[model samples]
Target: MESHIAFGYSFQAVGKGSCSTWGTGHFSTFDNYLYDFSGTCNYIFATVCDEITPDFNIQFRRGQNKKITRIIIELGPSVITVENVGIIGMRRMRTSSALKGPVKIVPPKADVGH
Candidate 1:
């Protein structure tokens, strides 16, 4: 299992059907990248971080704990994962769902036709 430090909490992404969440603000979240049949092991959860910073990522990778079995079973042996595929930045997006947060909005000035 690899540990990641995001928001403030440290989490370890372990074996098959395992998961983790490490983030501070609204734009923070993680999505499953599994490609084959949807995970039959259905479960949902949420976690809160004590602090948040702009920079957060895989804290440190240890040799023995760096097994790739979980992700391999998730995406199948033949698939490849794209860069930043499962990470979410919802808080930074401009949409109705974003309207409920602390984000500030200034309506666009109407265009005056010549």
Candidate 2:
């Protein structure tokens, strides 16, 4: 499994099903439902509803131009917020053992030659 860090929490993609939206508010649900929405607001795209307490939630914020402006992901005690401003920031839920400082983002190295 490949590990990825978003908003300071490390996770891996172990599931197959996924949801997606693109092109002027077009959306494709996990269950294969397709629709179009052009609202300028924050909306929940996906969330864990199997358990009494949700494990995670994903939301997207649409700007006035009908484009995605921000993405928010809530995983456990961490809330990761990514903006179209070119910087990825993370906010951890306040706790006695919460980590301090900002999370660093390193660009992946470009592959040269085959």
Which candidate ranks first by TM-score, i.e. highest?
Answer: 2
What is the Cα-based TM-score of model 1? 0.18
RMSD of 1: 18.8
Off by over 4 Å in 2: 1-16, 86-88, 91-114
lDDT of 2 by residue, 42-103 (tens): 88877766647655777777788876777777666666776664424463333353232222
Model 2 quality (TM-score): 0.61
Q: Looking at model 2, how many pairs of residues clash?
A: 0
Clashing pairs in 1: none
Compose the digit string of candidate 1's lDDT tens values, residues 46-92. Answer: 22233242111232111232211111111112222211113223222
lDDT of each: 0.25, 0.57
Error of 1 at 111 (Å): 67
How close is every model to the real structure, measured as TM-score? Answer: 0.18, 0.61
